[model samples]
Target: MASDGESPVRLAAETWESLFRAQVAVMRKLQAGPAFKKVALNEYDVLFTLSRCPSGWLRLNELNDHVLLSQSSLSRLVERLEKRGLVARMAAPEDGRGVLLKLTDAGAELQKDIGREHVRDISGLLGPALTAAEQKELRRLTEKLRNSVGARH
Candidate 1:
């Protein structure tokens, strides 16, 4: 939902509606599964973010900043992953007090396996709908949105 005009937001109603509706439509197309047999969508999101991290590890607060879930929910999710041997919880080496989250070897392998299927699914879904140029433009717009939202990874 859009907040009140307290932020530096500026978009015509039609433009916002198009953007939002298109996003919802695409998400719906990607929602079905067998694509992510090893992990649910939200869980895969966490693993995907970690896959891009330099060390396969992130501080919990940093992870919270990047993920769509709330910090508390993420904490519980992390616990579940840990219990399943997909994630490891350890003391942050940079600082002793905070917790650090790392994907296990098993988790990384699972992520790769699921990610391959997911990418193929995306290609199959989007290829006929969007031309190559349109796909590039879509990436540009999404990147702009990411940058607007504090440029978190």
Candidate 2:
């Protein structure tokens, strides 16, 4: 039954469609860039997090949380990065049982390159569509939405 003549079915369908379209648009924009070709976004995120870490190292668990990846998935990603000589894992000095992930010089360089490419891609996609003030407003709204959703958890 509809409340106050409101069409719940139509509303829900429209919401889903909007979300799907937005995701596809954003993904298409990101995928058109050289960064996507050079490294999968998730891998780049992991590398960027490590690159920003103090001493270029983060505990395995800390890195996993930052990337929002499952332990198995992060382990697989780390393994691949290690094989590429972009990251290395070592036992934590304070706790030999804990592992620490650190970026290699190659990883650092890759992160820098990808960061630049990402900036260029984003600028190309939205630079003309929005003025600086509009961009600032969009960032503000995005943060508000993020915080609202985060509060629900």
Cα TM-score per model: 0.84, 0.79
Runs of candidate 1 with Cα error greater than 4 angstroms are 1-11, 149-153
Candidate no. 2 TM-score: 0.79
lDDT of 2 by residue, 1-153 (tens): 367676989876886698578768976879777787877888998999998887777999999878868999999999999999999899999998999999998999999999998988889877887899998997897788779888998
lDDT (0 to 1) per candidate: 0.84, 0.86
Which number leads on TM-score?
1
What would the per-residue lDDT of candidate 1 be over residues 54-81, giving only the tens digit for each residue?
9777899999988889989999998998
Evaluate model 1: give its lDDT. Answer: 0.84
User: After superposition, which runs of candidate 2 have C-alpha atoms over 4 Å from their true positions?
Assistant: 1-20, 151-153
